[model samples]
Target: MSEPLVSIRSANLFTPNGTRIWKDLNWDLFPSEIHALIGESGSGKTTLAYSLFGLLGESWKYDFLHWDVLGYDLSYWSGPFGEELRGRSIFLVPQNPNLAFHPYRKIKDQVIDFFRLGLRSSEDPKEILELWKEMGITRPEEKWNSYANGLSGGEKQRICLSLALLGDYRILVLDEPTTGLDANTEKWVLRAIRKKSEEGKLGVIFISHDLRIVESMASRITIMKEGSAIESFPVKDRKIEPTTEYGKELEKARRFFL
Candidate 1:
């Protein structure tokens, strides 16, 4: 109904050496909608996420027919608007949480830096603790003063989530949000994401290799293969019946996870 929060048309992305990574991408995400991009590893899911935030590596090149977000063409953003867009319009929750945090800084200080740079507001330790609690981080106050290098993988992931939430972003790109967590921690992380989405008109592009999780969280799902989107379907479209090749593979994956 309202203007689509983000739109991509005829988008083609390539890595250096002229290896095509993603081609002919066309999609629209509305405000508050959760769109899932599912595929096997190396299917360009992360590449798409990086490109959206203008974080594509130097080796990669893209032609964005119409890549617009919040009424601006992202490809054309420069100067202060580019800086503003990074924190205000779109945020990325990286797959590897360890890559996001600095080992030398206290975690709380890192959060404070995020708030100062992105939010242009002072950090509220109380608010940060509250979000840590909501994300199921244990000993929030104690952990706040510790360095990221000291936290476990799951703990680091939660901290990464807190950093993203500390900013005011309309859209969040979650790249394999549950990759390294144990089952229990995975559930906790997923619950936190659900809670965050509930409170804001947030558009999310949730990327995952696990179809079951994608089916659970996504309103619309796109299946990618070999750097291209091979199928796009609603999660409720049907269950894996094992009657087709891809369907058979999907069934096998489900059974393996089970």
Candidate 2:
């Protein structure tokens, strides 16, 4: 509604072998909204996410790329502009949180580094500690001093979430944020995400294979298959009984979940 915070048009991405993973993508992400990129494995959801942040693997590249995020052409990121864009415009919470941290560094040090890199504000440390408490990390102070290797998978995920939040970028791209969390932790993280969306400080692109979670969290859903978007619509008005193939797939997925 308010001039899409992120816009992509006729974008195509290719693999190292010159295989096209995704092509002719046209979409827009607006401020204060949550958009879900839904698909099964190999559907190119994560690939698109990486492309949006200009982090696509060396083997892959885009054609006719035009990404304007927060009024800047992120698709052409290079040099100083790239550094500035990385810190200010987009923040990514990768799928594997365990890989995001430095094994030798304390959690607090990593958090501080995030701030020092201009990805977060100076007040991030204190705010993150508060979020850590909210995420059910007991003795938050002690946890802050702990190394990445010492924390459990769920704990690591929460730490990543905190880092993303602390950065406070204009847009946050979460790639399967609930991948390894237990049911309770999943709910907790979901609650925190809902709160973040409500605050209206950032737009979110939630990528997940869990259709149920996407149905519940995303305002709009893009159903992708074979590395391309086959359908896009408002989740609330999905109408499970539709006759289209994509709608039928949604129905089948819903039934499987139920």
Candidate 3:
């Protein structure tokens, strides 16, 4: 069998104040799979996405954060190793793109910086310009040179996603890519993500509260609650049954929460 693209094992997380949250938490992302990580607000779904890149918040701790990606060990990577890992191995698109870029810098410069950090090949300005057009940003040249303040929320999100795709990463983690997008943009973004996953280039771990979207996109489903993975199953299975009450409710009322 092929190895999983990434794995997290023996993780026991706790709040920074010394409150235990989960014990022996584990999960895997197989190649080319779209794994949906779903839960209500404050269930730690975004934290789990952050943990994959060792971006532990001030209020979090872990007994062990053992992780591996594409045959490279990142369990204890720090300093330069941590920088390289984040810049190349795994990519994360935050729900809020406002914090990702410097307000004072041009978007073009920021994207070039990302190219330098995450890529090893020679940079071609046209490549990013192409990405700009592909990401649905009209007038690529103008948008490319504009700073964050000049872009709309959906535009910023698309630009951020475009940046994420430029990296030669094995896994991509998305935290609610459709947060503020209009229906058309949302559909386009999701279609782009699904197309990428289907191309078998990398695995994607998508964190979202939208079960309807998850139902259509995910090859496997994982429901998390209170910092633990309460349930998980292959989406292709003939029957999916969750043992937790929360899961049952979520399954039954996919639209109510959204």
TM-score of each: 0.85, 0.89, 0.88
| Candidate 3 wrong stretches, greater than 4 Å | 57-59, 65-67, 70-75, 237-243
Per-candidate alpha-carbon RMSD to the true structure: 3.0, 2.5, 2.6
Q: Can you list the residue pairs that collide in candidate 3?
A: none
lDDT of 3 by residue, 140-208 (tens): 899888989998887888888876666677788888877777677677778778887778567999988
Q: Assess the local accuracy of residue 26 in candidate 2 as a C-alpha lDDT between 0 and 100.
A: 80
Clashes of 3: 0
Relative to the true structure, candidate 3 reaches a TM of 0.88
**Better candidate number, 1 or 2, judged by lDDT:** 2
Write one digit per residue (lDDT tens) for candidate 2, span 1-258. 578887888878788889998878887787777888876778888887777756764567677557676676754563357667777677788899888899999988887887877775575557777888887787888889999988888788888887776666778899889876778777877777777776855788999777777777887777778877877777665332334587577658764632
**How far out, in Å, is residue 142 in model 3?**
1.4
lDDT of each: 0.73, 0.76, 0.77
Which numbered prediction scores highest in lDDT against the true structure?
3
Return the top candidate by TM-score.
2
